[model samples]
Target: MAAGAPMGAGNSSRIYKGSGWKLLFPSWIIIGIFLLAPVLMMGVYSFLTKEFRGGVIWQFSLDAYDQFFFDRGLFGDEPPRLEWTYIGIFWRSIWQAGLATLACLLIGFPTAWFIATRDPKSRSTWLFLVTIPYWVNLLIRTVSMKFLIRDTGPLNEFLLSIGVIDAPLGLINTNFAVQLGLFYSYLPFMVLPIYAAVERYDFSLSEAAADLYAGRWTILRLVILPVVKPGIVAGCILVFVPSLGAFLAPDLLGGAKTFMIGSLIEEQFKGNAGNWPFGAAASMILLTIVMCVLLVYARNQNKVEAR
Candidate 1:
């Protein structure tokens, strides 16, 4: 009877293990339908010839990439020169994203540390407060930002009322406004990850370093930063990647005076130009840049793990 019972349990276990493989089919199907298909479509479209208005021909052409890298005269007959316009746009996006990431880090670290060091009973409240702003729609928040910083908006008016400035700051429709928007938009992303890491940290290690007569800066530089680095990296990636492709802050806050990569790609497909292939090519290029950033991070992680 005991031997028979053991055999029955073992058979059931094997049956469960065999069925587990089937469960992943749904997840695989979703990824294939959603993620891989769109990327493949973009890749193919990038190589195809563009049609007159909003479509692509089956024939292959590199004119999309050529247009990106080279400029001919208003008439196509002029000799091609290296193009700086799109390159400048890309550089500007990168610069703006980097600045936003830096601003998030500078403010988020201390905010996270303060929250993580609080009493356990109050930690949830702080986190809740941090997240509450996000429950509102992002578009609404962005528009509200636009209203607040406009030359005659409440912020400038308050400054004027306080007699701090003779005139309105005129913050609207400038690069500074765009940076402020990005920082406000992504601050929580930076805070939450760093908070999670800090919450898990062992404070005893800092105490030990102090007992050994290590200075506060030294302990932080050698011990705390190393331990919480993964979270910082995660926060930076979360903030930087989205900022790189963001259109809303740039378009609304920046007054659409300059084109970021997101706005440029959007214009290609949706504006009067209606260049489908060019849009696809731009998307592919952006994807490649993002992939390169991720790959570099992965390589650094691998090296750290090996060490």
Candidate 2:
């Protein structure tokens, strides 16, 4: 404990961090083993061809990526719709996730604006309201969606009792339901980031715009949106990334009518039972997709910040 004693490794570690150059062991180890390793493996896996027994043949082949992109099989009519099916699912996942992200943006932006602009006491209350669902389990939320929208459920019952339809309408197991489910589930994600941006904003900028003869719409369009874009980016990343991999919401809400990439990859793991190589390939494909989109987003962010 002597002040003059030689500092131990722990002390040196603390000293190095306190001086602001990090040498964090756990962080590096976690990233190396968990994040980087898996991604590298996936990239490798994506390039390899599937074998007869559900394992990779360990030869470098572009066949996996080729099949993924072209969605073609080894032969024909005898052909299962792998090519167009995979492409369709890929586009659908991206499209639906985009819709969900848009919905999240529309709903979350104004709410976050309201919450961020409130008085301190009111702000806390609103934030608490916004975040209360986090305490509820995610699976529970997705499952509960069915009852609310089902034929015998409240929505259909209400509609029918009031003669809104001749019969219980086919609301469940559709793209509309999937979109609603994902949007509702990820709404909190969009709100938190936008709220953070909104709260940190300089209100006087709006006032300045007003004094400069800019109207509310112009002020919002030119001044407000540009500044809060980082938050918009963050919100999109939060909502869209997870929505891409969300199998359960689509499965439960859409009742297996629509197949998401997540569900398809999941099938390789379990449904195709022992088709490990194909399953692994599918997983890798999904991982690559999520990574590519994020990389583009990150690059765009850097370009904006640099300017």
Candidate 3:
């Protein structure tokens, strides 16, 4: 009877483990099929030669990478010269994304603090209002911004009515317009993470700092920021990464004059100029940058967790 009992228990344990794997099998399959496969294919495509017609030739070549780094048209038939056009585009993307992230942080931190300081019953209501923008499609929101900021838009009408300016400001089709769209779209992402951190914070620390005669700025700089660093880091990552690859907002707001990497990539793939290989290479480069950011974020998180 004792031997039979041991066998039954072992069988039950095996069944439990098997069931756990069974539950996870579908997720693993979906990830491999949908996510991993596409990324791997893109990586493969990046190394291939582009067909003049509109597709990749599948012959391995580094022409796409060469064009990205070098290939000044000034060389003519000679060897490719170093041109910084693509590099400039990359820098512009980074700069725009950084500015948008900074704007979100500046605005979000205060907004988050406001929500966090609210009573528990009203906190949910305030958070809900913050998220109201998400209810509308991003495309719709961006388009609506165009209508509001155009020369003939309500914003100009209001300013003219108030006698603030003699002429209507050209708000659309400018970098400022693009930044505004990005800030408006991603503000919620920045706020939510910071709000989460603030909600979990100990206000007693700030009170103790105040008791020690620390000024408001000093307390905020020393006591509050350190504790909320993780959330800030998280919010920055969320805002910066998407803003870096932002497509719709830039396309709609910045116009043809302001060319971004996202627009460049779109042109290569779906636009009149269909060079899939070059597009794939550009995507890989962007992915590498994002991965670096993620690694840095992960390292910072680990350091915070250790402390």
The residue-by-residue lDDT of candidate 2 on 239-265, one tens digit each, is 999999888889889865578977877
RMSD (Cα, Å) for all candidates, in order, is: 6.1, 7.1, 6.6
TM-score of 1: 0.91
Indicate the residue-level lDDT of 4 in model 3: 36
Colliding pairs, model 3: none
Candidate 3, run of 10 with poorest lDDT: 1-10
* 136: Cα error in model 1, Å: 1.4
Stretches of candidate 3 off by over 4 Å are 1-22, 72-76, 304-307
164-216 in candidate 3: lDDT tens per residue?
98998998999899999999999999999999999999999999999999999
- The digit string of per-residue lDDT tens for model 1 on 29-132 reads 99999999999999999988988867889999998988888999787678999989888898899999999999999999999999999999999999999999
Query: What is the alpha-carbon lDDT of model 2 when measured against the actual structure?
Result: 0.83
Better of 1 and 2 by lDDT: 1
